[model samples]
Target: MNKIISAHPVGAGLKIFQNDPEIKIHDDVLYIPRIPGPHDSNYGIYDSYGRLVQTAGPRRGWPNFSLGQSQSSSISPSSSYPRATENSYFYGGHIGTHFGHFLTETLPRFWCAPHWYLNKKIICHSGDTIEKLFSVSWIKEIFEMIGLVKEQFIIFDRPTTVISLLIPGASFEENHFSHRQFAEFCNKLGRKYAIDLGISDPIFLSREKFKSAMRTIEGEEEITSILRNKGFRIVYPETLSIREQMGLFCSDRLTSGFVGSAFHNSIFCSSPRGLALCYGNSYSTNFWLMDQVNDANIQYFSTPTLLLKNSPRVGVPAEFTVDNPMDVANLVIDYYEEKSVLKKENEKINYGKKEGPYLIKTKFNSFLQIDRQLGKIHAGSGVGPRIHKIFAYVFDSQWIELFTLGGDVLSMDQLDSVSDTLNFKMQISQNEKTFSLKHPVTSRFVSTTPDGVVECNREYARAWEQFLLISANQN
Candidate 1:
């Protein structure tokens, strides 16, 4: 384990540190030796006075201290390392070719580049070539956005020493936390790059085209179809240019999709808008961090899924199926479509009136019915002429409590309404035909599991969880 060192704080989002003082370079310029790898044991950075720069070293608590470990440390360069030829900015450490990492972790350090180093070169320790970097159109566009050109990048493939190596502290950290300066930089880009082409249609960013389906949701096609039917333009973000992608997300419109790197494009939103994310079994805090800066109205829907141990996709280590596609779709539709309108509608519902001896239907095409013998609720196969399928919602001062109904009266156990299991807060659909139910107690949705067991245990409401109330009393 390498000893952790402290870096001198120069300003907000700026730190200076040193390591391995033996190979010294003169003046305030730090000598960032060729980092063979994090485990090389000798590679490090040093200040003018030979003090170690802590920022260049491994941060404690990272697994094997491998946040930025060099995967190709053993591969030596074909030629000798380039000598110190010209002045350059130190753009070393945590540099990568990954799009997501470049957007969040790597590009942030260069936020100050245009102001100070417009004429200077950027010295990077990564062995990747400029040609490969340029091959990624979005990466090249991002460079142009920051007033940087490919000519300014110096790929340090071998050991080299230089003078006055200006090292800037990272504006954003690994855990998705970013400095105020970084947020300001992003907002400035949002304003500069945001183009208004008069397009405000709701967009569903689909990752179905990506070759690597990491964390891909199974039954995503079914969900996409539902969104498409609701007038959401199904957008495959990879097919669009960086500018086009930015233009769509940066606008003040409803944006939604499966939670992944493609969604990270929301960082460029000049103005906050309605954003919905459908998640599999797992979730990422990166979106939450982006929300802290963007302030968009974001809603999350969880699709109950069983993680596949042997995923079919080539690069995907894990993938999950949407346990109830209809349920998931309804949750998203309710959020993007009816959230604002339903707020007013909810205020008008007279909880005391006879809402129903209602037949509750789920997106699964199943009817919510009681299984008295099991003392639990289950989604029945169809809306047959069964008394258990008929139910009523009773509001107990605050929450909409559900109870099994026998004939026209509410079912009773020991004289009181028998509602020990079902409780909800309802959001009526725009057409008043369907309703989304949220548990008043657990704050989850009433959903029918894959096996037909009904429970108010979903984090977000979906079609399987949404109830279409057919009031028997209504003519």
Candidate 2:
């Protein structure tokens, strides 16, 4: 890892746009189309001055890591590209796919859409057709909530030159805190369109449905069970419509959940209120900005655990188990409940487990064999249909315990070392057949090096870093 001697978070020092509707108008602009592939071309609008309009696209990793700043991928349009005689206002590009990003990044500039640019056509590089662009029901509802009709959108796929383009500066920085203007816009819009559901019970936003192979929290069910017994209602945000979510989150009730886009729904709350967040591994600085803008009484209960696999991004954690779900649930229970009404169910909560004597192999089809004498793991035996060594695994809460068929434990320390217990997290690949083991205590993956040496020291799980688990039959 390349260490920075003097590292600083870029967010605290960012220069945000003023809290007002500021539109930058450019005449005779060229719009470039992106050709999707291994190396997709950057798509954006370029002005007559030969400068890519910064407001036309989203900038990721801003004010965070040094490499976070996204450069303008806007290239010159070819002469053969079609020209649009009409003018349109810029909306956003590829960032619209995600709900959080759509709310924070794509629609932030649209704070001026209702009054200033209500009649102007909005142009974006999101999809080919308006139906495809607004394919998501809630997203379409949100656009309609802001008075933007389907006819008002101009979805451009191929290269097209425009006579005029109006670019509204984002009221908030991409990865930093949002401005008061943007916050107030969401507040007013949410309240205006919010249906009166009269939701009273405290809600726990569950990420169960949205859980992906890359970022799964293993012990979330146990935590949810404990919270449920304490009177916290478990809610899956994906199951609710945009209006229902707005109404639910806006109600005068305590909201708790793992830090994610669901928590971002708090932006629609009538005002800032109490939020109990279950956090593990790393967190985004954007939460701080959210709290700052919303004035939320945010309480973070850290459920620390090392990520099992590596995330695609630098700061994102791949997979982790909540160290102590009961501790976090207790904190939320104490903070929310005035009196404990249910105790019988809490005692019956059982954590899930997976135990197997399985064979572990590398992507190159090499079996992983442990050398107990040296306390080292290595890739051994070439591909063939024959008998070989096998391993067994047990789940300890969300932690995975790797053991030899002979009952030797896999430890970061030597086999017989009396150090802290080594905890491993198993991450299943997208294909589901392959898996990668991560050493949470040391934040390393059980990876095979270039020379075919197995070590729990890989930072990322690339092609050679992946492992496949095969179920072995016991005699």
For all predicted structures, in order, the TM-scores are 0.58, 0.62
For residue 100, model 2's alpha carbon misses the true position, in angstroms, by 1.3
Per-residue CA lDDT of model 2 for 1-475, tens digit only, reads 1111111122223333336756777777777654443244456677665566666666644323311212443555455568875754555444355777677677777776566668677777653456765777887888888887778777677667787777777766555446767777778877788764565778888876774533677777888998888777888888887887776567668877777776677777646555445344334545556666766655544443423444455446466666666765665676576432322112111336766656676776777665555434567774443322546454643344445555454433211112222346667677876667665433346677656576564556767768765766632
Model 1 segments beyond 4 Å from truth?
1-52, 56-83, 87-94, 196-198, 274-282, 304-316, 339-475
Maximum-lDDT candidate: 2
TM-score of 2: 0.62
lDDT computed for candidate 2: 0.60
All models, RMSD in angstroms: 17.6, 16.3
| Decoy 1 TM-score against native | 0.58
Query: Global lDDT of each model?
Result: 0.56, 0.60
